[model samples]
Target: MKDRIALIGLGQMGLPIATRLATAFDVVAFDISAERRELASRHAGIEATDDLIKLDSEAVIVVSLPNPAISRSVLQQLAPHLHEGATVIETSTVLPDDVREWQRMLEPSGVRVIDAAVLSGVAQMEQGKATLLVGGEDAVLADVQPVLEAIGGAGVERFGALGAGMAAKVVNNGVAHAVMVVLVEAFAMARAEGVALTDIAKMLDREDGGLQRPLNHRIMQRMAAGDFDGGMPLEAARKDSTLALAMAQRSGTPLFATQAAQTVYDIASGTGLGRKDYSAIAQLWEGWTDRGLAYGA
Candidate 1:
């Protein structure tokens, strides 16, 4: 059974995902940014549009927006027009409570809402190697397998019902951000202590699960070489980190590490490094300790 899919949001994360889906299915995709829409059309073969309602009629609708508010707006706009039995897959990071609310809003209209947050980064999408944490009804999930298969690259599986997928993504991003902060802090401290920054980075790269394996390592290498580009912008990272902290607080969960990670990103943002790759969090090192990473570029 061919599944017609519509994807909304064409930002950094969504564009690649939409592109992968378009490779296997006809995707009606839209982005709030006109430039992004045009970019997706050029690169992905998506039928890009500015109209949110136009996407509502597809067999399965996928969303990969920045945060909860934008995702909710898309859901609210599309909810009234979605056909019965249509599946709505949310790949955005959002609060679990909001996911339940969306489920409630769409269920009455006979629309099934599923949370399917993409795990890992955009580079994984090219290899179709990204993992999807899914939450929704079994039968509904079964119905959209082909659509999920085409886009998920690696695969998809249910964690449980309603907001479980989002919970997984929430925790995953929180921990990952924390780890990145730790990596930056340790490297910076080494530099301040008179060890060469590049040498320390080289040492870390040689350790098991080397930094170079992750995309950020490439960015870190660049940063160490004074390149400071490649990974997600520190501004975007700050937004995600902030969202994670907000979600944790709203749920009465303590995320001390997550909170600390937010502060580090905050420092990066404050230091005018928001547009730089998140690896620029190392600037905190250079700023506080006066040690600079020499970049060959």
Candidate 2:
């Protein structure tokens, strides 16, 4: 029989991961929201619930959540219910030390914990192109290859041991956040200096292999349409970047750029842009430049 799977959490990222697994595997999914569960059932073919016991029988259980606190809470609840030898995949981006600590907690129960952090955006998961870095026993990883293959259609790299996967994910995302913040700041500055925002972005696009064009264009469209309502909320980015700093600190290193980016993001989140996309950081720049970057109605 195919191993039973339990996917905990149905937030923006978790919902999609559960949905993708459910299409082929018999999945028992859980979320705090009946609305989210209903949405998942309708669109993803998974049986969603709020009960924790439903996970007891699942051999391969996955947890996708935000922050270490929530992950710890769920782990405490599941530790009792999880069967011996059941493989628990921790896909949340968290500190390596936390991952190691969870491993210690699960060890006594005979449950194998793997720090299986997902790479690429949530959108990439839909296309089965998400990369996975699995950090745990190679034998256990081989045992669960089917489930990992199902989720990571593109590739899965099994790092040597626990916490390695999360370390890679943190470094990768830290760089991405840094780049995103720099782009936002530069565009805001160009506009302030009376350089046509569009033209300056176009120049950057041409010189930078058009990497910023899509992002710049998206922001421009939103600005032009006066619909600067979302992209990646500054608050979430702030949290993730903070996560990066914490991870770096633990490693006895410093991320100078990430720190600077965090400051700008802090300003946005402080003023209620916490729910808005990270792109909205540009608004903070507008405030400093005393210019209206707001476009469109």
Candidate 3:
């Protein structure tokens, strides 16, 4: 029989991971909203319920929550119910130290904790293309590789020890956001200075004399196509940006452009563009400068 798994939090990230897990395991899921659970139950292997108490003592518990406090709350609440051999997989975007602390808390219950941070957003998770960064004992992760494979269709990379995966994810996302803020601001100025976005696109297309990365192609293509809705939403991006800034501050690293970029996202999120893609920062530029670079005006 396939091992039983209990998935908590059926929001954007949770729903996709739960649905995907249902394909390979018998999944029992919980969400604060009935609608989300109803939506998740459409999958073949899902059994949605409202009771956290129904989680089996031996069930592998996978949590995809919004923040550390919530993760700790759920862990504390579920500790007694979890079986001795069960594992709790945390996939939230949080500090690596948070995972270490969670592990320490759960240690007495004999329920193991693993830092399994998902490195992509809702759309990617739905398509089974999300990447998983795992940090735990080698033997524990090895035993759960199948579940990781089911959700992180691209692959899983085990960094090392208890907190490494979270650190890697935090840094990776911080760098990506920092770079995007630069792109948004620079392109806005380029359009303001009377350079056609088409001209800039042409320059970027050439491999020889441009800032080159696969992300450059994706963001440009998204701008050219005017399809920014399905990517990482602005609110989520803003949260990550703030977290990134905090992470930088803690490390005493004076990061450039990150705060300015985060401010842009803050404005966009406040103006009811939270559900839109992070690329929609270009819209904020259009509003401020009365110029067009992202949606081609």
Candidate 4:
């Protein structure tokens, strides 16, 4: 069997994954950025291209795009060219409905669509510690499990039928944002009570599990320093939040916390901080209460 795969989108997340996958299989990297394409091409065993038409012969195509619309667009462009029995692994954090749409459009062409919602930062993906929440036909997944496993060090699991992966990813991102907001608010309360962030960190570390203190510690440390330079950008974070809210409305589920968080995110984006790390969300709490949530005074 030919061990070739095409990877679309060479942004922050896609670039590292494509480069890593190149170590185990022939990788064709695609991105709109000439610079990113050039960079990935330098990696051994990886070919970079700006055109999906160049990937027409590959049996497997993995898309790690930014949003639902782009994922659908790329798949649509590639659908006409994908070989029969080809599997398109969508690793974007998009809506489940979007995944279904891809399936409907491509399955008739003899192409199989699967959702592989990747979790963890780009740095983690480079280290092969990322997790993929996968949803698709069982036989299709089994055929592509090896390639998927190569990218997921945190492991991959079949969550449900098509769209389940996206559903899990949306809920996961929404809950994460909601929790971050509440944590930031609680830390603000700690500030009001005259507790230093340094002291709070020590207090938080006292717990072993279930608190997510280690993760919380890193985010709080960055916020204290007003550092939102690099990480999951506020823009990408907002897409997940808004999508979650949309899903809630469609399902008639009350998502009070998520809705509240979205308002805060809206204000953050309005302030021209959308390109900054989602940790910039601290700006909201900082405005409500005067205090640096960082380690020092």
Query: Top lDDT: which candidate number?
Result: 4
Q: Model 4, stretches more than 4 Å misplaced?
A: 198-297
CA deviation > 4 Å runs, candidate 1: 43-45, 192-297
- What would the per-residue lDDT of candidate 4 be over residues 55-131, giving only the tens digit for each residue? 98988888988888898788888888887899888998889999999999998889998999987888889888989
Q: What are the Cα lDDT values of the candidates?
A: 0.78, 0.78, 0.81, 0.82
Model 3, range 169-241, lDDT digits (tens) per residue? 9989997876776666546645555778878777866764345633564357665566677777878878988
The candidate 2 region of ten consecutive residues with least summed lDDT is 207-216
Candidate 3 residue pairs that clash:
57-83
Model 2, 230-266: lDDT tens digits are 6656677788878766765665553565577678878
TM-score for each candidate, following the candidate numbering: 0.64, 0.65, 0.69, 0.69
Residues 7-109, model 1: lDDT tens digits: 8888888988888887888778988899998888886457899988887668788888888888888788888898888888888888778788888989889
**TM-score-better candidate, 1 vs 2:** 2
Regions more than 4 Å wrong, model 2: 43-45, 189-297
> Per-prediction RMSD in angstroms?
15.8, 16.0, 15.3, 15.5
Q: In candidate 1, which residue pairs clash?
A: 128-153, 128-154, 225-295, 226-295
The C-alpha stretches of model 3 lying farther than 4 A from their native spots are 201-210, 213-297
